[model samples]
Target: HGEDDHGVHDGDGPIASDPSWCDVFAAAAKNVIAEVFAHAKTPVETRRQLQKNKMRREAARQTRRTKVVRQTTVTATRDVQLQNHDDHRVTKTVSGGASPFVSAASAMQ
Candidate 1:
């Protein structure tokens, strides 16, 4: 019973008993496993990309903060310079015989 040994039925014939069917199933299983691995890897890659974008955004925000601080410092320095200039003008006008109170009032304005 050579056919009985291979478990081949008369109705199904040689194609059903072929070893190639096992190979086909193995290949399909391998493909499915590969797809599963790829899907599993995707989130890790996406997380890394998200981290990089977050770092970039943080760096840009820090740069904007630094620029604003620098601008505020410059504006403050300019204000001090203008105040000094007005004080000097008030002193000169008082020395030139102008009334001290009027010079002080004009400088305040």
Candidate 2:
């Protein structure tokens, strides 16, 4: 039938209308234009994402470095405090060549 030549007449047909050459060409051109724009912006978007990732990595590395420095500082302070406490202790020799076992604290009492 002539109707079949134009397009299917079935009410349940998937296509609403037959595609003309003009419509096909316009659709293809639109796709090509969109691809061109996307291609042009690809490098800019990639560089932006890379910069963000690098910043995040650098921030994490700085945080880790700060934590280690703080921990080392605290440990060094505690060691110096302990050393100071040990340095305050005093030892003395007894008369008649006795073993030098008496501490300054015991002598004070």
> Which structure among the candidates has the greatest lDDT?
1
What are the TM-scores, per candidate, against the unseen true structure?
0.54, 0.44
Clashes of each: 0, 0
Candidate 1 local accuracy as lDDT? 0.83
User: lDDT of each structure?
Assistant: 0.83, 0.71
Candidate 2 stretches with Cα past 4 Å from truth are 1-41, 91-109
On a 0 to 100 scale, what is the lDDT of residue 64 in model 1?
A: 100
Residue clash pairs of candidate 1:
none
Q: Compute the lDDT of residue 108 as modeled in candidate 2.
A: 62
- Candidate 1 per-residue lDDT over residues 1-109, each given as its tens digit: 5745666566565764578987898899999999878767788878688679999999999999999999999999999999999888777877788886856687788
lDDT digits (tens) for residues 22-59 of candidate 2:
58878999999998887677888786886799999999
Q: State the local distance difference test value for candidate 2.
A: 0.71
